[model samples]
Target: MDTSKVSSLEELKDLDMDFINDIGWAKVMWDSLQACLKKSFLNWVDTVLTMSQNEDDVKEWRSTFMEQFEDRCYELVTDIRELHEQVLVNIEKYLNKTQVLCKMLQADMPVIGQHKLGLYQEQFQLKRQMRELEQMVEARTSEVNQLRSKQLELCKNLGREPILIKDHPLPSLNEISDLKKHIEQLEQETFDRLEKFTTVKGELIEIINLLGYTPSTQFELAVITGEESDFKITEENMESLDLFLYNMKKELNNVKEEIYQLRTKIEQLWNMLDVDFVEREEFRKKYVGDSLNTLEALRLELKRCESLKRANIKVFVDRLRQELVEIWKLCHCSESVRYEFRFFDSDTYTEDLLELHEVQLKKWKIYAEENKDIIALLNKHHTLWDKMIELEQNATGADRYNNRGGKLLKEEKERNLLSKQIPKIEANLLDLAERYQLRYGVPFLTFGNTIESYINNLHANRENAKKLKLSARKLQKEATAINPSTSHMTSKRILTDCPSTDPKKYKYTPRKVFTEPKKNPKQLQVPKILLTTLSKSKRLSVERKKRLDKIRRLSRQKETRDSSTYIEFQNDLSNRVDLRSTINVAVDNETVVKENFKSPARQRGTTPKSVGKKSPNLPNKLTAVKSQIKLIF
Candidate 1:
């Protein structure tokens, strides 16, 4: 119940006062006002009752307000209380009055004079306004009449006369003859002019086409009107036309030059074809028949040569194979030689042989056995040979050096010792030389080869130094070519507005989380060493290895025992053997022999001393029996 909803009443007190006053009135309107005021007051009372604090006040006031106002506040309500005493008297007095006039409605019974006079005055003013409006309309109508008359006069002056309809009549023959003659003259002149125009149009169209124009469409023709046809040939336009013609002529000359160039290019292409293809064709025709015969002969000759070469190669291969087989047998590693021999049976063996003989003959010509054991032996022999050569050269100067007393003798003794080793060195060098000569058909120390070998070997270090210099130069060049610009990463902090702290407000901002990629450690390949042999007692010593191993085992056992699923009873009783520590049991007869060398000598000579009688309960000593058995093997 809002107080603002009380649209009619000012206040609850005013509403009650109005109600009481209306009840106090004696006139007929008093009842109507009383009813309205009562309704309004009741509405006000209902609204005030809904207010929170004045519920009791609103209820009591609504219930007693009308009665209290009627009884105590207004005279009309007192009259209503006294009306029962006077109601019949007033009704009788009003019924006794008979003053009446015949009237259709009570309001139309007029008795006034000034009001009728005012109506008359109003009608007179309205008539005066109507008269003024009529005079203005008549003046406008007269103006319209005058304007129409002037328009008709203007029409006559401009010669827009009304057409006069007349009865039909035939044209005169003389007029028709004159018109026909005029038409004839017009047609002839038009034909002659059209012929000239057509010729001009054709010329202009040709020029336009030469300028890369097609014929005009309807819209284009309309835009460039037909009257422009005469303007195209005028003296003023002739200079422009001449310029266009000049451009066309220039273009024509340029096209001619292009044509000439194209013709030259074509001629050059033709000449190329004629020189290349025609000569080839002529040669083909001339040689095709003779070449066929020659080819047959050549083919036969090539076949013979191939057969000879194959036979020679086969012989060479057979000799090499035998030598290689012997070498393999000497090496006691025949598997490699057998693999190389298998190549000889293949179709590509000839290619392989050619490659090998061309490039690798020097490398493989030496027998593998000679190569393997000869290097160290040859080095020893070469040292002795060098010493001997030095000594011999010194001996030749020994006589001149006799100024020193015992120097000559000492040198001679040294020379003799070196000379004694010469036979052995010579024997080895000769054997190697012979083997090389037999395998490669080349002498050991040809003069040209020795000189070339000395030159190449002596210059190897120099060449390496030169190559290093070139590589350094190239690296410098690359370093100079590299760009000097370097890229750098920088960070910046920017300041901006931030929300102030308040209990009612919260603000959010993004936080950038930059995570670096985690780098994992690279895995390494563990080295695996395969141990071949060991003594039986070596196995026991390896268990006392690293101190950390015991700690690791104990920790692992503790972890297992602490697990929820582990059972104490389930522990394995046996010790697990480490296979890496297992001893490989093998008996080396050489080792055994070496170990028991004295034993063998003793067995062949004297027997061990023994007691006279042994205990019957004890078993006989088995050492001698085992030793005897081992010796027999």
Candidate 2:
């Protein structure tokens, strides 16, 4: 009975016949018009507002309207009512059809057009749109189903079973494209996994053979070999294969670890016994492989070393103590730090004491390794510092200013270089220490004090020394002014005259000066005339002929050898390709310089220059080649 849903005369059949008769045709028609007009702007038919009561034409107009009511209003209203009902019926039919199709297709209609939105005439166009929507939905649905079937086939091949696909109810393009991409991805993954499986199985078999072990499980056998096995290319099977491979690798690693430890123990014993490099190398070559027999031999050697160690425990203990001291010195340990290990100072040469020393030595070695970078910078700083102190001590010498053999000038340059480097290294150490402390939540220590404290104290002492030197210079100047007679007897020797380490002696280079490997100049192309000697009549000189032949031979050699992967097979046109770069470049680890997100630039003078670094992404040292070349004009 809902007027909006009623589209045909048949829909009214549910009401009793008596009920329809009770409502007369005129009344029914009037009610129907009201129902149809309910979808329009104004629902009721009313008298015109311009009919005046006193005008003579009013009566005439009223009579005219009354006379034409049946033809002009009633007839037209009835016909429109019938036609609109048909339009509704057609629209409802198409809308229902589309809804059913979308529900079955499991896709959504791009839009569900509103009923009664357009005029009666426009209903035809709306109905057409609904039908077109239905057709598109059906076509896409069919395409999706076909794709799903293909996907299932792919899954079976890969031993994968995916859940049934239920595409989103609204979008079309995304689903179709996504499904296609997913199928392609699945195919690629399957191929890659199969290749990986083959490789892993092959490696597993080799490792199993190397370890001389047998596969107890049928799955293990299947993974190692492909015949008559129940292996599937499923995730479960892949995990199983990976696990078995991992266990095999773990076993191999354990064996290797044992071999390495044995070698280390032998090495430690060799050092204790003062064994020569030749004898050690021979031992290494003798027991080269990590086999059971090799392990047994190593065990026997360790036992022999143990007995030898006990026989001369005192000497062995001394060597252990010496090794400990070397690590301690590198770590810049104070004397008190060294004294903590009483076992080294003990007279007792028991195995327990020897083991304690070994443990202590091992502990310090690990600590040194963990802090090796900081240790390296500190070592450089200390070396340069010591050199500076030597230069200062020699500066006070009465006759040190003589530049005989340019020795004084060389020393002065060396001193200046050391002065610059020491502070630079210290600054690096400070920054590295700050990072270490922040990360570890403990102060970086050396010589039994925080490195920060040490650096600060050194800074204070350096300033004080400078002040003292200035005062001494001032006193000397005043004295010279007072006694001009004695001034000529003495020379005003500057820090440039400072004495330094012996120039004749060789020293290890720290700040190595080296450029990038030089590029070879372009090859000189020979003229075509020179290459062939146009006519042998004016015969080419013997030297020219020989050069041409050499060039021809070289060109052929280049063509043949260009793609060779062998290290020694050939090289570029450069004669000294084998030469090494002596430069020690501090490479940025995992360097992928990122663009800094722009914020307001920091105020120029608000932060201390020493406190705030310029940019986090900037290279630490400018002298490093890569940094210099990468950022320079």
Candidate 3:
């Protein structure tokens, strides 16, 4: 048979078993054979129909072939189903293996993730550090700029340009370090120089102050001369300054020595005069003696011998004059004694000076012996006089006004005692003066002038006090006349006018009842014209007419025109009444009865209330009346 067309079972049996046993290849051959068989059967159907005489046998033959084919077509169906299940299982195993591989890879590569995280962290840290470095660089740049500005400012202030190693915009770190070191050195140098300068200047100033000189200009000159253009603190300059300071100190020492010498001279001169510096100066200024060689002249007489002699003479004369004045004061010597010594010139008494001194000393001794008791008496009298004057001053001082009667009485007693004592002392002083005058042929220390002056002052004071008292009484009387109501309650004028002599009568008492007087029938009757006018006037209501009639009745019943209550009621009526209508109604009448119509309840009162319960309206009316009375007055 032909190999390509072999379709029989003998040809299939001759095929290779290996080829037949291959399921994939066998299945592909079976599918191809089935498709070919179907195609051949379809093709043979037409031919068979054309050739067959029985159609039913052909149909039955086709149905039997389809059933056999159907039975044979399921031969590879189980293997195909098994192959599909195996393919699914392989796919599941492959997926699981891939997942496990992925897990293993993930587990093995943990270091990569950790490295990535560390890299990220390092990146962030680097960024932060970079930011910090950038900030530091910016700060450094700003600082450098500021330093440049400061340098420029310093250069401007110095009126110069900055000197630098290089002309760069920013200084290098080395340059900055060098500049800082230089600045520190300059500061230390400046501080040292300033400290030395201050120390030297302080010493110079103290020396100048001690020398009593103004230091500002001198110190300036010492530190800097006007001729020098540039002043710098160098070793040479400082040495020169030290030399100048030394010279100044030497000059100050010389001046101090001279001053000390001058002070010594002054002390010697003061010793010569037996006076202190202050006393000598005071004597020079205020000495009242007629001497060519005054204290000042003696002080100026530089020759020690002449000055000493002159100063001795001046001191001697002063002592003599003081003794004379004392003796005169103590003994109250006659005018002759004062006249004899008044112009006693010490210069003209060269030869008789000792004799004069002896005579004056003897006279002083004798006068002192004689006046010792009198002096004691005078001192006592003077003390008592001073006390009396003090008491008198106290009596007349502002405090006197506040003094109570007891104090005043005590003061008066003291004054009387002083008066008695003063006279006795005066008599004793006069007796002593007479005895001294009679015995010594010279007046004693008689306070006659002082006593006379005091007596005169006392008299004058007494007269003044009497006049003041009289004037005060007159003023009081005038004031009383001016305002009788305000006069003192205890004043004689006020007390004299009091009705009762008994003091109890002045005490306050409750008021008694004040009855209204019976009305005059003639006064109570309203004039025919007023009654007719009131009845006719449309303005007058019945109540007002009745009120007017009531007021008229009250007025008629009043007995006294001076009654304050009646006057007040009248004033109230006048104020409340319509004046124009009232005048029209009673134009002819001398007394116009103007009345205010009140409520029926108020109008019902026929009698006035007690003064305590009187109407408040009464005061206003009374004020009006009083004002009118004042105007009349």
Model 2 spans > 4 angstroms off: 1-197, 216-240, 273-283, 291-293, 296-300, 307-312, 393-396, 406-419, 439-442, 449-633
lDDT, residue 340, model 3? 71
What TM value does model 2 have?
Answer: 0.42
lDDT over C-alpha atoms for residue 271 of model 1: 39
What tens digits encode model 1's per-residue C-alpha lDDT throughout 159-230?
A: 343222111211233533454454454445445544554554565555454444443455235223455433
Per-candidate count of clashing residue pairs (backbone under 3 Å): 2, 0, 0
Collision count of model 3 = 0
Global local distance difference test of model 2: 0.59
lDDT leader: 2
- Candidate that beats the other on lDDT, 1 or 2, i.e. the better one: 2
**Clashing residue pairs, backbone N/CA/C < 3 A, model 2:** none
Which is the winner by lDDT between candidate 1 and candidate 3?
A: 3
Best by TM-score: 2
TM-score of every candidate relative to the true structure:
0.13, 0.42, 0.24
* Model 3: how far residue 563 lies from native, Å: 45
**TM match of model 3 to true structure:** 0.24
What CA RMSD would you report for each candidate? 46.3, 35.0, 38.2
Instruction: Specify the poorest-scoring 10-residue window by lDDT in model 2.
Output: 588-597
